[model samples]
Every structure is written in C-alpha cells, then in structure tokens.
Target: MVNISEKDIQLLQEQVISLHKEAVEGNAKAVKDLHQLLERVRSDHSDIPLLDAYHGSTMILIARDKTNPLDKLRWSKSGLKLLDGAVSSAPQNIMVRLLRGKAAYKLPEKHFHRARTAIEDYTFLIKRQIHGEGFLNTKRYWQLIYELGEVYHRIGRNQDASICWLKLKNEAQDPSFLHLLQLKLKLLEGKPSVEYIPDAESPISNLIRRAANATESELNNRLKQQKK
Candidate 1:
C-alpha cells in the first residue's frame, strides 16, 4: 500500500478549496491552478486508485455544477472531453457514463435516447459493481432508478418502468423514498396515491418520516380547502 501522510490529505483539501473558489469566481487562473494541483498530486501518488476516483467525481462538479457560466467550458459530453483523456481511464467506467447522463440532461430533446443509454450504462455498472460503481447512499440509487423509470415511462414501456420503480422502492430504506414509492406503486396499481412531502427533521430516518407525514397532512389540507 502506498503511504499517504496527514499532510498530504491537508494539501489536497487546500487545493480543492482553492479550486472551488476559483471555479465559483470564474477565475481563469484558478482553472489553471486546478490543473497544476492535479498534476502535482499525480506526480507524487501516481498509483493510488481512490485518488483517481476522487478526481473523476470532482470532474462532475467542475463540469456540471460549477457556479460561473463564464468559467464553464462549452462542456460537451460531461467535460471528460476537457480533462486529460487519461483521467477518463479510471478504475471503472461508471463515473464517465454517469457524468455523460448529467450532461445529457442539458442536451436537446432529440438527445434523450442517448441520455437514457448513458444512464443505463451507469446503472449497469452499479449493478455489476464495476469500477467501484456506487449506490453508496440509498437516495442516490433510488434517484437514478426513478429517473430511469421516468424515461422508460415516457417511451411507453410501462413494464420496464414499473420494474425500475419497484427496485428503487426496495433499495430505499429512507421512509420518504419508500413512502413515495408506495404511492407510486398504488398509482401504477390503479389506486392513484397522492403526492406528499415528508416534514424536515434531524437525522436521516426521522427526516424521511417527517416528509411522509407532511405529505399526508398536505393531502388532508388540500381536501379540506377544496370544499371552499
């Protein structure tokens, strides 16, 4: 195993913070600085797999969620196009395809098929656990599954969409996602469950429960108000 010191982690953190500031401010120098920082880290810890994953993940923010439009590259296909092609060759191809889907959302409606394909590839990667493919958080997995279901539903593939939603409901331990899933299931079953938002609270599980309760309350309120 390669030895990494606390000092190294601190240095990486500092670099990431600086890059974020520069990225937000649309500072061209910060863009160059990020490249330099990445190169420096690569030079020292060339063999670390996790570092590559971190970098790939960071690329998602830089390429998609960066604050400054001026700082944004014309950004075609997730800006994997802008970064070193070598960075694209991380342990697994999951991040690459996921990023492609993120970018695909901004593309023209005509490109939806491509977007769906990209998301499917990432989902497959997750299912196969390729390249450390992730569903680390239940919410993230369910979100993707629901999105996949949405696309499927649009294409009138009701069965495939149902499968996606069912898998999502099962994977989501968070009651909010699960509760939402139940409603979706009911609707698909011809019951038409109403939409609801759980109330916000501390701790993830409680927060989800609150969200579910909030939804029921909302429905009751709507029914009450409707008589006016």
Candidate 2:
C-alpha cells in the first residue's frame, strides 16, 4: 500500500473543493475529473468521512450526466447512501452536514423524499452558525439561511421559512441580496394557497448562485495555479 502524507490528503481535498465548484456550475468535464480524483482518494484514504461525503457528492453530480432514468436514480441513491454513512459516522463534521444537506435539497422530493433530511441538516448547521461554531462566512451563512427557508417552504412550513428569511433580511448587508429577499417574501405570501416549488432559473436562485460563485474566489485561484 502506498503511504499518503497529510499534505497530500489536504491537497487532494482542496482540489476536490475546486472541482466541486465547477461541477456545480454545470461543467460536465469537471464532473468526470472530480469523479476520477475522488476515486483515487478513496483508494488511498478509505473511511475518511470528508472524503466519503465529497465522493458521495460527486456521485450525485454524475447522475446528471446519465442518459437513462434508472441509471440516474441508481447513482443518486448510491451517492446519498454514502453521504448518510458519512454523516452518521461524523455528525460533528459541519462540512459533511452541509454537503449532504445541499444534496438532499437539490434532489426531487417526490422521488428521493429527502426534504426532511435537507431540513434537518440545514437546521443543524444554522443553529451552529448562530453560535459561531461553523466556518461559513457572512455571505455563505446567510445563503444557508436562504436555502433553509426554501427547504422549509418545500415542506409547507411557511412560518419557519419566513422566520429564516426575515432573519437574513434584518442582518444582510448586500443591497441586491436584500432586494431579492423582499421579492421572495412577497412570493412566499401567496404560497399558502399554492405549493412552493423552487425554480432553479428564477432570479433569486441566480442571485444565490452568483453569491456562491463569488465566495469561491480563493478556490478558483488555487485551481488555476494547479492547472499551470
């Protein structure tokens, strides 16, 4: 067995994070690269909770490239299983929780029925963030709150959703983000009579996506350096 040093593992993890950002942004080639990188990591560092969680995330991303419905579902299920195992093994790992939470929320509830799981993970992270226990900076922290509210609305918990959104509205400093929050609140008002379904292409969703992209500046720079 080849012995991998801690520095090697850290670099691998950093590469994973960089690739994950591209994967999220709809880079198909990045998906393949991320999958290969994660496979290499798994071969070297079995049972590392962070690696498992990231590999699981890559599996879920790979599902998007599958042409067959059955294949997509199979990949998603397998990915989620790995994510669940990671969380169960390292419940205190906030990064694992956030990755699983995002995965659960992104999945369609009718098929995966992971809405509650998403809510649980987000809520757990939110509580920790409230206590300054997590690593999320201000923008990502409020972004998590926004995402949590969306999950709440998914499950018809309007009041809870409102609370989350309103809390962000009160403290968030970005003008554009605050404007979107106002628009979202208005949309939420009419949600009681209609089921709240999130549209990925919606303006608010795009804003959040942009915010996420902005937050990864450091990771993006590291990726560029790695390429050269």
Candidate 3:
C-alpha cells in the first residue's frame, strides 16, 4: 500500500472538494487544474485505493466535457472500472465504499449489477451509522443517509425509503436536510407503505421481485441469528 503524509492527504482532500465544486459549476479551467492535481496525487501514491477512487471520480467529470460520444464512453468506462477495482480492493474501507456506491447509483440502468452493489454498500454504511460506528454526527454521515433513502426510493423500496427518511427527520438538525426529509415523508405518507409487488406479466419484473424477497429474507435471518 502506498503511504501518504497527513498533509498530503489533507491537500488532496481539499483539491478534490474544489474539483467537485468546479465540475458542478462548469468551470472548465478550474476543473482541469484540479484534475491535474489529482493525477499528480495518483502518480505519487500509485497504490493508494482512496486516491485511485478519487482519480476515477475526477475522470467522470472530465468525461462530461468530452464532445465526442466515443471519447465520453471511453472516459466513463475507464473511470467506473477504476472505481470498481478500488472498491473491490478495499471493500472494508467506508470512504471507498461510499464513493463507489454513490457513483454506481448515478450510472445508467444498464449497469444493473452496479445498482445492487451500491445498495449493499449503502446498507452496510447505514447499519454502521445505526450502531454508532465512525463519525455519525458529521455532515457526510447525514448526507449518506439521505442518499441511501434516495437510492431506496429509486429502487422501488418505498418502505425502506420511508424508514430512512423518518430516521433522518427525527435525528437531523440541519435545516436543509430536515426540510428535504419532511418533503420526502409527506410524499410517502399517502402512498402505500408496502413492498412493491411487481407485475407478474413481466418476467423481468417478477425475477427482480423474487430476488428482492430472497435478499430480504436472508437479511432478516442474519439479524435473528445475531440477536440470539
């Protein structure tokens, strides 16, 4: 494993934050500069999984600026592959897992396996937060919970989504998050609180339903075992 000084790590983190802000604001020159800084970090710490993941994320932003469809596809695929490798290599690293999960969640539906991977990571993170592990009171923790709720909502797990939102509503003090949680709760209130039952006529949907049910059953069984 490549080791980095604390100062270097802090600098990398700051640059990454700047990179994200610039990417969001479409500041091409700033994004380019930050991307170069990330590249230098990767070169210096070639074996660092976290840096690798961050580099991959930066690549995605770079891809957004590509004019050619093929170039865009190439960049996106390379970035995602790097992220996937980093996550696989450091499966227990919460930060790496969160990065991979969030990136995977934003990917297109054709990457179905990535969606499942994201869900698993988010579930593990949420469980960790619930058990008082790590920095549970931080902004990142709250944002992770909110993102998990959004993922659940996207994946047709309305009940799970509602549970996440309700938890956030009760514990969150940040006005921005609290306001969003309230809206989510209000939207979910009148809707059915049950698991989504897919149409039996669609084989693909039925398969998904069956798989979800099996996963839920396995999780419940594990929880029961842990309690014993």
Candidate 4:
C-alpha cells in the first residue's frame, strides 16, 4: 500500500480546491482535470473520508455536466452515496459537512429529498459558528445563511427564510451581498424587487457566484491541523 504523507495530502487538498473553483466557473477543461486528480486521490487514499467527500463533489459536478438523464441519475446517486458515507464517518468534520451541504443544496430537492440534509448540515455548521467552535469565516457564514434560507424557502419555510435574510441585512458588511439580500427579501414579501436594477451585474448571479466561492488560501487555512 502507498503511504500518503501529510504534506502530500495538503497538496492534494490545495489542488482539489483550486480545481473546484475553476470547475464552478463553467470551465469544462478544469472539470476534466479535477476528475483526473480525484481519481488519483481515490486510488491512493480511498479510506480517507475527507478525500472521499471531495471525490463525491466532483461526481456531482460530472453529473451536472451530463446531458443524458440516465447518466445524470446514476452519477448523482453514486456521488450522494459517497457523500453520505463520508458524513457518516466524520459527522463533525467541517469540510465534509460543507461539501455535502453544498452538493445537497445544488440538487433538486423534489427528486432527491436532500433539502433536509442541506438544512441539517448548514444548521450544524452555523450553530458551531455561533459557539465560536468552527472555522467558517464571516463571508462563508453569511453565504451559508443565504443557502440555508434558500433551502427553507424551497421547503415552504418562508418565515424561517425571512429570519435568515434579515440577519444578513442587519449584520453583513458586504455591499454586493446586501444588495442581493434586499432583492431576495423583497421578492419573498411579494413585492416588485426586480424593477429596481442594480448598478452592476445581476444580483442573482452575484449570489450564485458567492455561494460557489472557493479559494486555495481559504482551503489551506481550513485544512490545517488545528491545535488540540
């Protein structure tokens, strides 16, 4: 068996984050590259649940890129299974939860019934942030709130969604996020928010890009061995 070193794992993690960032940006080549890199990881360290989570996320990406319905369903289910296994193995692992939560959020809740999974993961992480126990920064915390609110809205929890959006409106510092939140809240209230155009790109796209945010520095920081 090949023994993967700590440094090697860190490098792999960095590559995974970098590749995933590109993949999220509609880069087809990057998606292919990510698949190859993850295949190598799976071959050498299939036992590592964190790596499995990454592989699972890549599978979801692949599924999204597929045009055939059967292929999409197959990949999505396989990816979800891997994500479920990883979470089952390390329920408290922040990265595992984040990957699975994001994947679950992207999935069609009507078909997968994974809204509850997304809600649970985001809620768990948010509670950790509240207790100052997790590594989520302000940006990610707010993003999670937005995603959680979205899931709530999908599941007919408008009041819960409003609470989340209101918290961001009251406390978040990012102007772009604030703009998007206002529109979302207005729309939720059955108001004509779309009539008020912003000075830049579409706020909905901004929110999607922000939700897909990933960076090597952020991943490196999160992947560090915390001092216990």
* Top of the candidates by TM-score: 2
lDDT of 3 at 62: 69
Across residues 1-228, which tens digit of lDDT does each residue of candidate 2 receive?
A: 578888988898899999999997779999999989888768877779999999898898887666655666778889999999999999989999999998887775545667789988988998898897858887778877887787677667788888888998999877877777787788778556335454422332233223332323443443333223
Lowest summed lDDT across 10 adjacent residues in model 1 is found at 192-201
lDDT of 4 by residue, 1-228 (tens): 599889988988898899888886567888889888888768877888988998888888887777665666678789999999999999989999999998888875545667789999999999989998859777778778988987777766777888999998999876766777888788688633233313222332232223322322342232231110
Cα lDDT of model 4 overall?
0.76
Stretches of candidate 4 exceeding 4 Å from the true structure: 190-228
What's the lDDT for all of these models? 0.49, 0.77, 0.66, 0.76
Pairs in clash, predicted candidate 3: none
Leading candidate by lDDT = 2
TM per prediction: 0.44, 0.79, 0.66, 0.77
Model 3 lDDT tens row, 130-192: 787874556667666766676676566678888887877888776755766777777777666
Residue 65, candidate 3: Cα error in Å is: 3.8
Q: Which ranges of candidate 3 are over 4 A from the true structure?
A: 1-26, 38-45, 66-70, 108-113, 174-179, 189-228
lDDT of 3 at 44: 65
Clashes of 3: 0
Residue 226 displacement (Å), model 2: 30
